[model samples]
Target: MLDFPNWQNWIEKPSSIIKKLRQKLDQMVGVEIKLAEARSGPPTGMALNLEIRGEDFNQMSEAVEEIKQKIKNIPGLVDLTDDFDRSRPELKVIIDRDKASRLGLRARDIANTVRTAFNGKKVSVFRDGTEEYDIWVQLDQSFRSNQSDLSSLFIYTPSGEPVRLSEIARVDSGPSYGSIRHVDTVRTITISADAFRMPGPVLVMKTKQVLNKLDLPQGVTYQFTGEDENRKESQIFIGQALIIAILLILVVMVAQFNSIALPLIVISSVLMSVMGVIIGLIVHDRPFGIIMTGVGTVALAGIVVNNAIVMLDYVIKLRKKGYQRNEAMILAAAVRFRPVVLTAVTTVLGLVPIAIGMDIDFSRESIILFGAASASFWKSMALAIMYGLGVTTLLTLFLLPALYSLVEGGKERLRGLFSSKEIVY
Candidate 1:
């Protein structure tokens, strides 16, 4: 954290720096890796989280000894652990579809019924003299855990004839692995063999590199999609908003100053502000989220133009006082330097609360008018502000002045020649 930040109370400094540093470290690696394994073979593993095409669980197992050896050798590895090898869970269950049909049911229906029975879905409750008890209707636990007993469950058809559930469906058991899901798609799980001293990104990258060379089983597949998806979506949104924002900013400034040429000068500072944004993202290694992109871009519109406005305001005064164009620009630049710097700095400092994810009461109507948003939204906003202001301030106060002096001087000279014929009357 910079000591001379706009807000200077030295509260919550450590967390902010830590957050920034972690993001930076993550960017140095080629890619993040993820892998998943499940009980394999026929019946299409996909029924639960059907295996992805091209990912070979069997092939991955073959490399386990090599993986184990390398992991042990790596000095950077802080911790290596496994969820399998005695620690592994039993995912095996057999559904007798034929037996289920005999009971006028499907295997899914039985599984759902069994899960519901244990979970105890509430039916209703009647309060009796303020001593209320919950009323639940579900299958008894005895019926769920026992496989042989399950085959003995009785089912009655519409004809009122009693029949054994085993008559229609078969019952069996096997081991299955829990899945890691993405957007409702159960992809694969990355078993983290190491942590501690190992950099999080390096482990993720190396695992993927080795995994890539190996061939996967015919149908099962695996791939990596961690922050990449998040980053893509953010870039798209930020990119769209960025384009629209630039256009809108031009519209607003052209509308405000009512001069096409002047508006061009005004808009140049926004581009300069982006230079700061890139520096910040590089410095902090932020992923350029849509929220950050939007906030930073919008901030560019406001913060960047501050210096331009100062210059413009001075130019207007000189023009109104009937000064020559070239001399007026140079004077305006000199005159407007102080307030422009102050304004940009003040705005950045003012938004520090939002950048740090600090909380303020927004429960009551009074606080709502000026209070923090919910945690997630507030955090995104704060990051937007923190990054946006820092970037915009640098471009606006320093680089913008140099750029403005050049662009404005040329425009001013052209305007003078064009208006030279104006009457002195």
Candidate 2:
């Protein structure tokens, strides 16, 4: 762990290498090597936070250990730690108020006496030249090592009579931490780990599955925080933004086409493009909420409608020139075929590099520049738009024409039904 390189030149991922090292460390009982991810931005880790409202520390500790074992069995979760240290033993001095009062000794006197003996209160600063050091006065270490020794220490009452500490107070030894932590005004113990090879959302999904089967006791509750919380919130916001973007696109389409029916046909192409986007993601096994993919979806919305408008506008012009509905649609598609295919090809070609990642290897060429973690950040966006536009181009040519005919045919049937003369029986 000492003198580690800032950048690695190995072919295997750093995380995988760290995992191997961690497994070696795990073989020896009570020896742990926490491979904290050396990265920028918010740290990449998952936390299963539990809030125990009850004051029973032993019960809470048991629950925490149980949860630790549960998460430990989960796949793709590594470096599991509950962060509860039990080795540190503490001695608590409980003063007997009635005994202390009868002995004419104040509780403060006993506390100050114990603190001064154990902690050695600084009485002065010893200075030599420009160097200075604190001068603390306290009894030898032997006097504070055991309860019997501590109890033998003397504290004076107001009447100047010395009283043994055992007469007024008792010392109890147990396991405890130096400090307690509170989050949002509630005591919380967070069990956290590094998520290796699995995306944040996937890790959260698997962890929740393990949590669901366990029947938690009353007053004991858990929450998902860290990357998982941020991922969920971002997904919600992105979904809302996509909806608003679609609605805005629809309004613009309505204004352009001047016919609500025609715009509906154009919007159908957007849905058609989703199939290609999904196929691309499935083929590559990329998660959807990586920021880039959501952005691509929104960008796809605008790109998709442009092609539909091109085809639909020509169809409308043909209809206005007195051509039959079906014939006009067919001719419009035939005429726009080259332009649509060309545009889609150019766009897809533009994104191919980012989708597949840059050909340059940062390992040997410039290890420090790229560090690790591969260059696939924008891959999702590129693949989404590339595949979506390809499918959209074809759908715009064929399916759009058929859908237009069907919608127009439906309108005609509706008019005939409403305007026909009623037959009298």
Candidate 3:
């Protein structure tokens, strides 16, 4: 309901605002609030959603309450609540079958008479002009509102005798569930909360640690849902995709170089790039975005290897021209330095605007800085590439050449050792 100005105009972050609101609201008696950021993506529900499932509602509700009590005080967990609501007030009627049968009245007759008295009966239809309306008849509000009115009411028997309804049935009022939920044909109660000032996964891990200490009843178990579930699934998918990408890149490099060692040397750049990705996220204090950052890392695997491949390929060409191994590597580094630096520099420059959410308006001749919501989504990916490529570029120029030299030296030593051995036969 409360729509604020654009994100650029906000003086404080949304988290700060929610924290202030929570501080003030927590003092109010019987008041609870759930605050969430407006995001455009798949529905992930709350940051922490734990579901306690069982066939017995009573046991499941007790377990859910116990879990909530244990986790309610956890730091950074807010808006703690559950889906097991049983606060609705309802009236139940119990019928005495023997009494009703002896009076020549069936259970259906008593049910119909009580239902008609309270909910009204459609006795006839009224036609006005071209439309028809149903006419219902029932007791007035004053007469039917009190429980004592049920005892005064009468039910007609099959022999046309009037029998007091209270003699055959009794009514009791109590609290009942507002609604019930089921998952996979099993009853489930979900306890959900938002994570504040802490990562969602960390909060979930803490909650799990606390819940694991409890000995739940038989046939009752809990599982995390919502964002936790989605996060796990996404991590698995991205991990598999990253592996497939590395394998595919390795295959391509192998075919191009026609040598396993050279391709593996090129692939080492990917591992070096991963180090940069971690450094970037840590320095920026941003969580690792599973989808964006992961995809960016996979894409970086292909990009960083190009610089290594370029430098290594040129060294091979130089050596093929009769230059010594050390001389060829030195010359290749000096000759290819400009092109390699320029390639990485241009890519980093291109991603700078996106990473910082900056845009240019030619018509207004103005620069928009950190004003695009869409830009935030891709910021992780852009930074992943920029930082990764930056680090890999340096390593490609320095460390990769050393590794190539070491590998080549080892290969030559093995070849020379084999040739030096005399045949025993």
Candidate 4:
């Protein structure tokens, strides 16, 4: 394992370093290398993990090879390989049932003899002091090195008669799988790779496009697993959580204000915050971290509403004191401006250091900027809240009061219309 200095000291980005290393490593003969970035959260095995499952091993192996060939050329995909072990050499003993029966030897007896001769059978226990070991009996390596040697071995029949192994069975040598993997009692072959400069989703999308051309055999199916699978699942879960949070916030706001319009007006700040988050990510050239950013968005739903609630609540209180709607809105803005701006500014300032990965070392009496890995992990969440609260604060102070006046004016107009039409009833 290799460890490097802080990211601040690096002359080149980690992705560029990995790419150069990959180029050099690819030139080495008969070697496979997988380079992965350390990340937080549950281990997902690999960035791109696809499982091809089927009943027939031959068909699955063929499909695995075809898929590998098709995807090996995808840009930014590295360490393309599979879990199917095809390099192991195996020897098979084919018993002739007729010959064995004529020789008074059952197939099990022949198999046991072959297994014992090669794999060794535990015959007895040897005791030395308080320790014991099982003694195994088997042919030496010199006597079982080749097919000819194996065929020249002896086997005993049920009647205690010795017979030559070649008379009843044949030994064949071939390449076989070293291990077999199963999922739900069905054989599975997994192909996995790591993403280099590109994002996992983009690499997976490109791989999917290539895999669409794959013609799988009957009963053979493929599914994506590993980090790609975990990412999709996390996206769905975050989306659901965001929706539930919004709903709960809406319910609480409605109960507090006793009017749907006020709650909806406050909820508009949440939308503004979302827009700000999107814009911030784009401006900073950062990918929208699904988990961190999503959680931050949900948290923003509760926070951004505070400014709107404060302003709107003040407007309502002023109106009860016999102030006109427009006057109340203006006064509410003037009175709440300092509180709202201060709140937002303090929060944004607090997160600036975090989003930029800045830290202060009291011992060294120096400022460290962009040198913390943990800060980098949480930077997305901080930026999300900072950008979101900043935008929503402005909207709450300016646009929110205008919306309140508009809604109140519309309400009065409706009331007048209803009151004037009462005679028609």
Candidate 5:
């Protein structure tokens, strides 16, 4: 997928259309904005990573708070989240030379000794599963005791000297640099998240506001990127493809019907399918989530169009073969019943995979979309097609009869135009 390498570049680069749209978004429903990487991980496109940093724990916490505010203020984002404690690592102590020399010690000694105390070194080595494991013995919790013990601890010098750690430098504990997690490496020191209620333009605007408001500290910078970015690219590409597909369907319908008006009537049955899908979605109380709404909408159109074509083609064939309009309509209905039933039933069966929410992740939103897209959903879809199809059917059955009757009744009126009133029965 194409990702904006630098969202900052795009955000900073002036676009009149984008600016105007943003203004309207501000005036209307507002927007949700965010600053994240296009993807996390290394450049190989094989992973994702999030690296967060803060001046101090307090500063880190403040930065996090700022992120929360940014997320909340985003226009359509809701349920902002991240993996809890995913980036959180405990304090790890590292020594400073100047401070250590002021007392009488070196950084190496403190580092080495502390390493042994916290993370022991290998005193023995063993082999297991074609791999080597180094084992060592060292002081545990009760022995190390507290920070006071670190100062009181003694270390040996290269000159066969022993000195108290406090005499050489300060002993402290603080947050560590690296973070740990299950998935792609996302190491954050101080970061926050904001999710929007909707995707597309709404999320973009909200994120814009956040980026504009951000006040960066010296040596601190950020970027705007995430799944939202991925979504935007996908939406654009799919939109074009969908337009092409619809045009193709229209062409196919026109070719089959050979009449612009009736073809239009049949093609429009797609709308009934859409209405039914929407009603099902609404009744099931599912919001238009990222995945569910997109695929479901496209699928609905095909279902409706296919159904209409079956019925219309049969009726048109009968009419072209010299049967009276009403007779043709009834005959078409009788002949098409088996095919129509088979098609509808098969389509519903095909939906079983969808009903299982294959695309919707195992998240709360997924459940909502799937539950809302309940079994009765097909019924709603059928209702819309039924309305259009029923109307077309009735017109087909009654059109020729009505026209003939009207012409016969007007025979008297026609006599005025004929000089020799010779009428043949």
Candidate 6:
């Protein structure tokens, strides 16, 4: 319930320190503490927001407790808690309608008397030189501490007789009323937690697995919100963007090459580049489907095609200049090898440091490159770009020449079969 100012020495393991403090604090009476750190992701400090809705508060409280337990079992999910507090003691006054009616007392009179007694009635405002304070009148704290004292309160009846509250009302002690949350007109309870040492997608997958096993009561359902919702939405848009980019690239290539086959040959190399992307992510222990990784894959699409386009253009020029198909292909591959290798190597080398987490520092004030947290943010992108470009370059030099030869040879064979004059019967 308290936030400590940054007055203590820095510790490397804050969670461990908090655990130690919890152990000591548990033994003390009337004091309890639970430490929670802010959730990590985007600008919203929420990794998981599970909203449970039901008509009954008791069922909802039980469901919240169950979910909190399951969340604790999940690895790297920390600081789990719900907003409801159902254990606090409260005193409820149940008015007897028949007894109140016989005494000529209305329910409103009893309610108003109880409210005025507990909440205090403000009578007058005392003005000071610069400040005004309200004077309130209420029973002494000692006389209002227990349910027996509340039952002993007296209120005036309509016949001008004073009757004890116990004559027409009863006081019962039980669980206090907690806050009720509403979403779209239905009551809801949210259980939230922070993910530690894991990404948002992975945590969401794990949470889904846990939730799938539960058999929720009728009229009770759950939904995900906060960062998880945003992540899902962003993934859909990213997929659409990638598809549009591919279509745009294909259209441009079709115009430049004037042939569907050549454009396909160029676009197919993007798949080859994706092989290297998968390998890089696996080898570097990074998760797939990250925003930066998708960005790198899109960038690789444009980059990998450049080399193939250059080599193909030269082959076309040579063929038009009266060179044989086989001769032009051999020459194109040989002459373009240096340019292709040089371009790929320069680009890969530039990004290799970033892939390996050697951060690029543009600021002259700091020479530190590696071991910073921010450096790893771009690690997935760099690895995808570096490996994708390298692998696709090699595939372009070798596989592209073979594909072109096969397509052209098949066309030549079909032309000879259709145009031949010789016939035997």
What's the TM-score of every candidate structure?
Answer: 0.49, 0.83, 0.88, 0.93, 0.46, 0.77
Give the range of the ten consecutive residues with the poorest summed lDDT in model 5.
Answer: 40-49
Residues 1-425 of candidate 6: C-alpha lDDT, one tens digit per residue: 43433212344445466666656775777544455543222466467888899899888888888878877889877656677766777788899999999988999999988888888889899999999999998888998888888999998998889999999988998877666678999988888877766776788789999989987777888998888887778778777887888899889989988889888888888899999999888887888755778888888888988898998999999999999998999999999999999999999999877665564445546454654444566778888998899889989889998889988899899999988967779
How well does model 6 score by local distance difference test? 0.81
The better-scoring model by lDDT among 4 and 6 is: 4
- Give candidate 1's root-mean-square deviation (CA, Å): 12.3
Lowest-scoring 10 consecutive residues by lDDT in candidate 6?
Answer: 2-11
Q: What TM-score would you give candidate 4 relative to the actual structure?
A: 0.93
lDDT of 4 by residue, 1-425 (tens): 55665555778776677778878888998877776666654455667899999999999988988889889989888898888988999988889999999988898888888889988999999999999999999999999888898899999887888889998999899999899999888899999998876778888899999988878898889999888778888899999998888788889988998999988888888889999999888887778878888888988888888888899999999999999999999999999999999999999998888888786655556746565655767888898999999988888888998888889889999999998885653
Put down candidate 3 lDDT per residue, 1-425, tens digits, no spaces.
55664556788877688788888888888766777766544456788998889999999988888888889999989989988888998777788899999988888888899899999999999999999999998989998987788777889999999888788888888999988899998899999898887778889989989987998999999888898888889999989988898788888878887889988898899999999999888887878878788889988988898899899999999989999989999999999999999999999999998888786555456746565655767888998999999999998989988999999999999999999999997
Kindly list the per-residue Cα lDDT of model 1 for residues 70-99, writing each as its tens digit: 545544443333322322344233656665
- Model 6: lDDT of residue 154: 92
Model 6, position 37: C-alpha lDDT score: 44
Weakest 10 consecutive residues of candidate 4 by summed lDDT: 361-370
lDDT scores in order:
0.54, 0.78, 0.87, 0.86, 0.52, 0.81
Per-residue lDDT value at 335 in model 4: 97
**Poorly placed runs, candidate 2 (over 4 Å):** 1-16, 36-43, 47-55, 120-149, 359-373, 422-425
lDDT computed for candidate 3: 0.87
Which scores higher on lDDT, 2 or 5?
Answer: 2
Clashing pairs in 4: none
| TM-score (C-alpha, index-matched) for candidate 6 | 0.77
Scored by TM-score, the top model is 4
Off by over 4 Å in 1: 1-231, 256-261, 278-297, 316-322, 351-425
**What overall lDDT, based on C-alpha atoms, would model 5 receive against the true structure?**
0.52
